[model samples]
Target: MEDCGEHEGTSELKLGTTIIAVEFDGGVVMGSDSRVSAKEAVVNRVMNKLSQVHDKIYCALSGSAADAQTMAEIINYHLDVHSIEVGEDPLVHSAATLVKNMSYKYKEELSAHLIVGGWDRKAGGQVYATLNGILTRQPFAVGGSGSFYIYGYVDAEYKADMSREECQEFVINSLSLAMGRDGSSGGVAYLVTIDSETVEEKCILPAELPTFYDPDTIES
Candidate 1:
């Protein structure tokens, strides 16, 4: 479950899902698989992991569902206040820094990792990864247990000059591969694309997911 902390209660939902974000030519694309589980049982199949923290900024969550969701909410509220104080839109870096500080301060108690990405007038499009008291701005970021299976693929396939459409396809393809291989990641795929003028949200259902291989042609 992606190094999740021990649940204090049996009823707590554990989210061991895949979350990723990619910076494209004009903006950022963030996505996640919609499956929440508790121990060996699946509790929810359509949970949204992409959260809007500000106007164009969003975060993709992984690890304990409760911890991640609570953290996102707190960050959202703070960013709103910060924007009001500054009399301008908040930068994506500021939102990510808030997440990093909180995550680091509560590292002992919280088991969550997040990818913060969005568009700002100053930076255009940016992607930042935060976890284990560390924060880095990258062209792309992936998290959760499913990430272990796709590191090599992402490293090999990612391109710095990818267009918006290519980035979207890349996220969907990567999620499909992970969902096929990781038992914890499944159900529909939720994606959000943020640019200077628009925030686009889309969903890819299980039946509509792209097929990558023929089972009969594969070796177990």
Candidate 2:
């Protein structure tokens, strides 16, 4: 069984089932599968991995479910307080920095991977990831156990200047492909798209698999 959280000197943490984000010409697309597992067993099938911090800012959580939820709540609360005091929402970069700091502070105890992305008034749209206390800005990012499969599709299909529609399709196809191959990943899919002017969200049902027929069964 894989350890989901850090304890004493344990450094390994279970990855979330699947979460992916892609950057396009004007915005970013983030998607996650709704599956949670414990070892070889599926514990929950409707877990949401994507969180909305504000109207414009959002994040995808991967790793221990408890840790991810707790950290998300903490970050949301902090952002809420900051907005109330400053009379405006923080930029996407600032939000990523805040999460990076918190992750670093609790690096020893918490085992959560975060991908933050959103539209910034000054910087337009951006995405960033936090891993083991280090924060990196990425053109595209994938997390969880199925990330390897997701990356395969993304690397082959992603373009530097894809249209918003194209990017959305790419994200959906990548996630569906991942779910099909990764045993630990499957369920409903949640997608969020963020641009300079608006943030849009959509929910996608699991893809239907095609029926396979054996050639040997056919009569000549």
Candidate 3:
């Protein structure tokens, strides 16, 4: 894969990262697995990738971890700058535009990609989102895989209406499978979800066929 930015030549990326957004009667819910790689796992197994940046604004990010962090920094700066410039944080609208511009501009160097979730107030307030994602309608995003095992398993039961737990289980397992078959992805799995008030974090161990298949086997 091409280097997105500081994460240059970084071959080991995550596999089966699935971000699912559901709009409920009150607000929206978003979820993602916590797996960074199958072969290598960093400490702090959990990351708050999803955030309730504002009362109505929530964000979830995925992609090259480093690139994702950079983009998030840029986003945080952009929001602050624009907020001071306009006195009101246009998080949702601005985030959508911000991500699009970043992705379009740094598609080659920045190791960044994203799946954003949030809500905006046009009149009554509505949840809005954008995704320049690698996966179209599939349940998961497999970045580092041989395309045989990862895709095969993810596509087998990728339900758009899956629950948060189900999605997490499927993605964590998929990462394990990819790490076993592919050289690019393996390690541990992470999960983050956000709502109107707060964000939650969960990490799981890879499901490889060895002495390491327990869900409690997390590194970070």
Candidate 4:
């Protein structure tokens, strides 16, 4: 923790999962499904699932939903505070410091697992997400039930070499693949990208199912 908030101490909780990120082309995309099931039964409570903070960035998280929500609120407040003080886009690093502190402030039992992405005005491009236990940014990150699968597919496929549209397609396809294989994940997805203007929202694309054909028509 480079700089954490004032608190007695705090720990983290892992709850519903998610996958999200910033891409090479200065855009952002986030994805998460509405599946929190066990033993074929599901949790009845509704969660925000995925959202944008500061109107300039997007986030998806896995951990204590309660904690994640509160942290998000604090982050929103901090962004406003910075905007007023600096008269410019809030620096992601400043947001990180605030989240780090807030997490510790509420660290006793309610701690969130989070990932955030945005456009860094100072850097003149979109910033990727990193996982350091705070609301800070990273180059690439994934969360949620299918996160491991989500990360695996994209990590291998994503390249600074790919075009913005190409990267977006890869992310969409990767998420669909994750939903298909992971029982705890399903439903549609939402995505985004942040640049100077911020591409902050996109519709989720469901996984592609293989087509079935008549056996007689098969070339094999």
Q: Best candidate per TM-score, number?
A: 1
Deviation (Å) of 171 in candidate 1: 0.4
Question: Candidate 2 residues 1-220, lDDT tens each?
Answer: 1225444577555564788887776678898888887766788887778999877888898878888888888888889999899998888887888889989998887878889988877777788988877888888888888888767567888888888888788777777777777788888888999997778888887644222334478899
Task: Give the root-mean-square deviation of each candidate in angstroms.
Answer: 3.0, 4.0, 7.3, 7.1
By summed lDDT, which 10 consecutive residues of candidate 2 come out lowest?
206-215
Give the residue spans of candidate 4 off by over 4 A: 1-14, 36-40, 43-48, 104-108, 126-137, 198-200, 205-220
Model 3 — TM-score against the truth? 0.54
Evaluation by lDDT, superior candidate among 3 and 4: 4
Clashing pairs in 1: none
Rank candidates by TM-score, best first: 1, 2, 4, 3
Per-model tally of clashing residue pairs: 0, 0, 19, 18
Scored against the true structure, residue 55 in model 1 reaches a CA lDDT of 95
- Supply the TM-score for candidate 4: 0.73
Best of the two (2, 4) by lDDT: 2
List, residue by residue over 1-220, the lDDT tens digit for candidate 4.
Answer: 0012223455332244556564565555555555544334455323445656676655565555555666777788778887989888776666656656665666675545566666666653444443333454555567765777656667787677566677567656766677666666665665665667646566643434222234478587
Every candidate's lDDT: 0.89, 0.79, 0.50, 0.58
TM-score of each: 0.92, 0.87, 0.54, 0.73
